[model samples]
Target: MAATGSRMGVVGGSIAGCAAAVAGIRAGAEVTVYERSDGELRGRGLGIVIPPPLHRRLVGTGYLDAAMPTAPVATRVWLTRVPGERSAREFARQPSAVTPCNWGLLWQSLRSAASGARHHRGLPVLSVGHDGDGGALVRTAGGEESYDIVVGADGHGSLTRRVLAPDLRASPAGYAVWRGTLPVDASAEHLGALQLLRTSWVTIGFPGGHGIFYLIPRGGDAGPDERLLAYAIYATPPEDAPDGAGHVRWLADEHFPQEWADIVARGEHAAMTCHPVVDLHAPVAADPPFLLAGDAAGVTRPHTASGAVKALQDALCLEEALRTSPTPAGALRRYARERTPEGARLVELGRRLGRAQVELTPDWAAMDQGSVDAWCRATLAGTSSYLYADTD
Candidate 1:
């Protein structure tokens, strides 16, 4: 089991860090979070789909509002190409039971729930090493501190991972994603409650790859108004970084065909953000007393949009191992073994999906449809398993 009467230090203050702190606290360990940022972390992004089982647990634990305003259930995912290309249409219809929510809203709820935890903001970790006996030492901007256990909840570029698992490298998955949220005006035809609530859309350009757009409802009780959030991720190679002119310009000038220029033009210049699609193979265990969790251990491409899900899974699995194992080192080992399979599977799936989107000239229709079906089935199964594991 986790060493009793021990203090735990969590590095990084995002979702994974916060969740780890909470779990550690609940397991009867004193926990402290060392955050690199001095203030709150905020960003606008696409909505996140929360599995019903996980959502129920968050509600029961008071981490989410019992009756918070949420977007309509996502019953259909429409896939199409730009410029009304009839030959490029594809669709995946999900059961009417699934629900989706804004990613920002979920973060807000998690942040609020972690208000009571001890947080040291603006204190970036400089180094982490053993204290020569059983405890670990973490050097931060402020000073050095020791703890019985150290948790690396930092993101993909984790400092702890660098110190511990130096060989675990993130390889670019050959494609880059440009994502942004656009405002929906009142007169917009696609802004109906049912459409906005339950229908998620993905438009894949023929030969050029895919673009996904979805609507997420924000604000409680007041209901979604003039501001409906729309986000899209377009595929591009890693070496093709767009300049300040905007993604639309980059697409029109460098990548996209003339027919898709108008669709690219719809995005606002200031809203576009670029990110490389990257994931790491599961790392070998580096140390016995320290452990990796969340993206620090491994990452899933945004194509699956399961980065958050995998991080949450790491937290839950680590919590279980820590609670049940006979020793602290044993718990860490078990955590790694339990998590490696799922992490590797997600990595493989993400890369395959990304590859399918980027590779052109290979029977696009058959390839695209097959990918969508496989994704839907895999997502549903993963969600069910995650929810069951979390609640069990």
Candidate 2:
């Protein structure tokens, strides 16, 4: 642990920020968190996945618990549409273990874990800079504060990153993911018609893109009323396709299976959020007093299913560095050395997958189980292996 006198500032009080505050406090540093938004963040409902191994590691670290609401996923099925078929034909089924989580609920848990740390909301961070004595200065909407260290958990558009690495920015990867979620009925009439079990995460592939669907807890439980169907469709829509859910609904009509189409059409457009997929990797993750973590350091495509895990891992790395290194500068250097390559690797893997899966897709109709297995192995190579490489 650092000296009790050591102080740290964490900007962006979301998932990464909250985790960082926990790390700082546990390292014996006085920590303060500044969140830019005023509204309750719990309302931003979304779905996230944690592979079983990483989930176990986080639980061991007390960052997560089995009691947290999660929908267990046992298999991932890859399917393709066939002519006159109401549902896509399954090409491959890969045995897997994952826990699908509600984004809001996960954030609430992390926020609770960091409850002891001072958190200031509705205060936007304007700028950050280095102090001459190897410390940092944070300028917020209210005023400027000094700290021994400043962490950038502010996400893709980070002010702290501007001071650390001015040239790095999140670049669009030439595609977008249209996502939607809606309540699931107990009768299971809607989802049951699709012939997919609740334990399955289904992936349907077409000419220009793919879609994935699974269940997430609405109130952190497995009860029927607590679950919602969450889906994400990845594709490069026509230049003239309507924005947001309209584009997603149009794609559903054109490419999705009949049953899948019905599920999407039943959803209200207001519940969907569509945005371009972007990626970033700042060549260096830290510069003296200013250190970057989470989306500010690097961003891999959602296909990797590692965003939340990566962010939490960043906090753990920061904690380890502070706990082990002899000096603050040395610790920052070590953290950067360890995370930079991992960040670059994820970015490269995302590009490779984006190219093979979206840009230059294979003929789904022609692929057999063998070919599907080979293609999937090639595309997803190294992903599972890298899940908890540093921590484990």
Candidate 3:
């Protein structure tokens, strides 16, 4: 694969798409990025964390900046309610090292890093194919174009994945995540609890659900006091749970912590977002010049805490493959071969964790410290480690 004069097209202009563009350029390819969104992507998303190990890897590889604004997490406290308990009881507390990130900021950094490439905004790729000579043909609403290589960084509904692996689809995991963010002032009444969680990420576990909440840097150019209370509540929706924000409120009221409930009750109509949990993986990753990256290749459960890490890693690996392989075909296949197993493992780990934490939960009231540890070990048997160490 000669680096010079190679043309590469990257679908999707979000985080993974931008990273793919960067990879293509670093490999000496002329790159073009196609983003479906018309306007500038606003920094809007719940808290996203990059584990310390993955953080170091990404920063070392120039995919992430060391100085990115992040809230350093010092502890993970798991709380549950028992029959006689007046308040949430903490049965497990572990020293946790995690860095919480605002998703929009991360995307902005990746896009800036890939500034060398030409980005085509407001264009959505409709389909993809091969040019019969190890080249890729991409069809968008505007027109069709050919490139030496095509990367599907488009999210779950990837056109490249549909062409490459039509059978692969994201399946609902029988649960949902009701997520939202609240300003620090919105949670002023819980100042004491907020102080306790200054350096801690708290997880409140119930019979069939759990909520993880932590402080995150506010989006955009936020001041020092500007912080957000990010909460993700996972639960099985009730029969009458209305769609959209109503469902978010229903789930939050039923399962989330009281602090989260209070924030939701503040009458911020657009505060919450509801998303159905889905897991999917494509059996094959690459077919010559056309390849899949990020969620297009496989979407692991957020429980693995490797969604963003895996996406960035995919682009980084693709960059290495292109730089080292003798042929473009070889590079694409090598990237796929190396990443498929890691994707499968993370998806499986997510399913396992989801089952343990949501579907088939343990009786929290009856578990002791040793029991909790044992349960975690048993449920996370194949997940490598709590911090996603094995994948690295």
Q: For model 1, how does the per-residue alpha-carbon lDDT over 6-103 read when each residue is reduced to its tens digit? A: 68888997877877776676566677889888876645455665556666776776656666545544344444433433233444444433345666
lDDT by residue for model 2 (57-159), tens: 7668777655678787777777777856667677877766678888887887778778878899999888888777779988887889999889999988888
lDDT of 3: 0.78
Model 1 earns a TM-score of: 0.81
Runs off by more than 4 Å, candidate 3: 82-86, 242-257, 264-270, 386-392
Candidate 2, poorest ten consecutive residues by summed lDDT: 383-392
Model 1: residue 223 alpha-carbon error in angstroms: 4.6
Question: Which residue ranges in model 2 land beyond 4 Å of their true spot?
Answer: 193-197, 220-225, 268-270, 381-392
Location of the lowest summed lDDT over 10 successive residues in candidate 1: 383-392
Candidate ranking (lDDT, best to worst): 3, 2, 1
For candidate 2, what is the lDDT? 0.78
Which has the better TM-score: candidate 1, or candidate 2?
2
